[model samples]
Every structure is written in structure tokens, then in C-alpha cells.
Target: MFQKGDYTLEIKFQGDMTKKIVGVYRASYFDKLANETRYVVSTKFQPTDARRAFPCFDEPGFKSTFSLRVVRPRNLTCISNMPIHSEELNTPEPGYTTVFFEKSVPMVTYLAPQYVVVSSTHKYHIPLAKQAPNVEYAASIAPKMVEFYEDYFQVKYPLPKLDIIGIPEFISGAMEH
Candidate 1:
């Protein structure tokens, strides 16, 4: 939707267990544009498609504010739209995970990408995972999922914390969150 080198802010909102499960992801212009730039100098993205990249009503006229947090393992470094804010080690079963929370990005629902993953969930140290996934491949070929996505996305991750969770029941392969 945007070209690389272009800058855009995103505040993601999900209706998960938390009413406003939000995270701030950073987006930049890619050398390529999917359809057209909504804004001229800088676009105001409100995508109709599923990307919902950010938060928005898509009702034509609206204004909103947002907040974000990224969680992962302490040792596993994360990348967001911007640099990280804080990193906290958490245990209590979900130990091996780090809690990363960041500020908000400015964008529409359709255009914002609130969900991001720079690596595999097992990489973050899922002590309770029962069995840590052997990415022997995804890890060996590309040790850092964050770096892979950063290149794949053509945009830098735009938040403080980058959370990667593994869904054992997901399709036979890896799934991003």
C-alpha cells in the first residue's frame, strides 16, 4: 500500500481477551504501491481490505487516539516501527517472555498494521511450551524472524515491543500474530 522509505504511524487494536488489545506498529513507504497512495505527500490510510493495519472506524469521518505494547522473551531482542521503550522479564508460567509496551501511531484502521512478528514464539523462551519448536530451518536459514519480516514487510517494525507467539494448532507451518 505504501513505498519503502515513506513514513507512517500505526496504532493497532484487536478484540482479543482485552477489549482494546492495542499495539503501535511503524510503517513506511515501500518502493511499490499496491493500489494508490490515499494521501499525497503522506497518505491517511483507512484500508477496506483485511490489513486493518491500524485502528479506524472507516465511517468516512472520525478521530481517535491509541496506545501500544509488545511482549516477548527477555533475551530475544525485538524491533518495532521505532526503537523500544522498556523491556521487562516476566515469569509466572509465561516467564521466558518479555513485556514491551510502546506509545501510539497515527493512522486509519484499514491502513495500519497493528500485528507484527519478527521471530518465532519459541525463540522468546516459552518455558511452558512443553516443547520448544525446532526452527532448525527458519532459525538456521534466518535466525531472526524480526529481521526476516522487516525485510519481507519492506518497512521497519513500528513499535517498542515485538511479540511472537506460537500456535501449536495452527496450519502445519508457522503463523504470524
Candidate 2:
């Protein structure tokens, strides 16, 4: 039996990073600059895939805010639902960097992604070096699209930033988060 009161719960668990293109997975692409295959870690949590990454309510109606931190190789970058708040380099471990992201607004589990990527440079959108030129058209056009939508819908975008990434091994044509 229980009374009406406040409660807190904590759970710790780990999940495997898979080679498939769903959930938390690794993908590889040829690097023309380095002449080798490089791998990146990314996520696709739409339509109920978030449970595979971590323990969660895993339902559309179970909305909650999240603050995320990730440790990755010094050569890569991490992106989450919110902008980065701080980054610690080579402290917890050598050759590894820890990134902390800001707390997210209340959102469904599917929108809270833990996306990490590998790139040669921290340029716009972090596309592979070879594909950088191709991003120019999209970069120029995106603001117009956003402006059109904002004008048509008369509602501002809820997030501070919108990151559009290109996944070479993605299974779906597009995903909002």
C-alpha cells in the first residue's frame, strides 16, 4: 500500500551497439580523403525504437525532458535533442571526450536521440568531406523552407536549432528526429 507522495527511481543498464541500421547502430562509409572506411554511430528511434538504446517508458504518451551526456573519441562529435552545454576533453579517459547537452523540452521518447558522428571537420551539418560540396544547395534552400512553413503555419519552430544530417546507410528516406 502507498500514499500520495513524491517518488524517485533510478535504473542503470547497458545495451549493445549493433551493426544494423535500427536503434543504436554503427555505419561505415568510404573516406576519399583518408582512403579508408570510417564508422559513425547514429540512431533511428521513430516508431518505437528508443527502448533498444536505453530503458524508458517507450510510448508516445510518456513525455519527459532529458539531459544527455556522451563519451566519444576525440575525433568525433555528438549531437542530441538540445544544444551542447559543455565538453570535457581527456579527463575521464585519455583519447576520449565527454559531451554534455542541455536539458530538452518535454518531448516523446522517439525525439530524444543519442546521435554520435565522425567527421573530418566541424563544418556545416558535418557531412563527409567529399560530400561537403553537395550540401551547398540544401544549405541555401533550408532557410527558405523553414520560412515558408513558419509563414504558412504561423507557428515558430519549437527548438533552438534544427540539424539535418545525411546518413549514407539509412533505411528510411527521411526522419524528423
Candidate 3:
């Protein structure tokens, strides 16, 4: 599967059967300075769109949090929204390891994302619980994103907590709720 976005976003199954996507998820966005602009991301991908991004079931009604797992050769790196639950070396490889991400929160179809390299972003990939939290991405580009949002929105941080992730690929632009 593609490892471009922030969260691990994985799921584990007990049975041995192949799952397939039934439909596609779509979204859009646009600038408002013109006063009538409409923009959207993750647009028309047909019935099996998610597969274009990654190999997985692309149905929406199948709403459930996934236990996303990503494996990378030690030479490379992985970035996700949650902290690593465990790390195990896929034996007999010098530059390979299995990085397991903690389970994600309840998610719906329109609420998920496919990783990519389409634009520039400043995402803070925070790890661990709250209360004077210690950010895992200390040297990340989040500081800039915070500044931009804090000023434009003219509001304190919207959420009690935030976890931002910046990937390097996408056919469309950035996305948000």
C-alpha cells in the first residue's frame, strides 16, 4: 500500500479472504478571495479509486478504524499520525523493519486520506497522549502551519489536540474538513 500520508491507517483481519472496494470517496476545495470559488480533493475515482492510491477495499459503508501497518527498509523512514506500538525487524534483512501503528479512531469513508506528493505542507505529526505532550516530530514543519492557521482563522487551536502529517504526493491539492 502507499505510505505517503501521516497516519498508519491499517486494519487486521482474522479470516483469509481478499477484500475489494465497492465505490469511491470524493472531496473538493477552492479559494474564496474571488467570493465564489469551489475546490475539492479526492475526486471521482470510479468504483475502485482507493486502489489507484493503494491496494485496498474502496467502499464507504465499510466504516471502521484500521490498524495500519507499514514496513520499510531501514534505509528509508516512515511518518504517521500515531506513535509506534511496536517495532520488529523482518528477520534476515539489514535495512528492513516492520513499523506498527496504534489503532486509529473511528473513521468513515469521506474521512480517510491517501498519501501522496502533490504540494508543500507544514504538518505536525504528534505522538503519545496529551497534557503538556512531548511531540515526536520535534524538527517537523508544523511550526509554520500553526502560524498560518492561528492567524488566518483568528481563533485559538480549534481542537483540544491536533496531529498533522505532511506527505510528498497528490494529484489534487491539500484537504480538510
* lDDT agreement with native, every candidate: 0.40, 0.78, 0.43
By lDDT, the best candidate is 2
Give the higher-lDDT candidate: 2 or 3. Answer: 2
**What is the per-residue lDDT of model 1 for residues 1-177, given as tens digits with 9 covering 90 to 100?**
766795666644663221121223322222122332211011123224222333346642443334445565544444433335565567423555544445556544433433344332333533334344553344554437677888998987654454333322122232222
TM-score to true structure, per model? 0.32, 0.87, 0.41
Q: Can you tell me which runs of candidate 3 are displaced by over 4 Å?
A: 1-48, 52-62, 109-169
Whose TM-score is greatest here?
2
- Candidate 3, residue 60: the lDDT equals 65
lDDT (Cα, 0-100) at 27 in candidate 1 = 29
Model 1 ranges with Cα > 4 A deviation: 1-46, 49-56, 73-77, 91-94, 111-115, 120-177
Lowest-sum lDDT 10-residue window in model 3: 113-122
Model 3 deviation from the true structure expressed as Cα RMSD, one decimal place: 14.9
In model 1, how many backbone clashes occur?
24
Backbone clash numbers for all candidates listed: 24, 0, 21
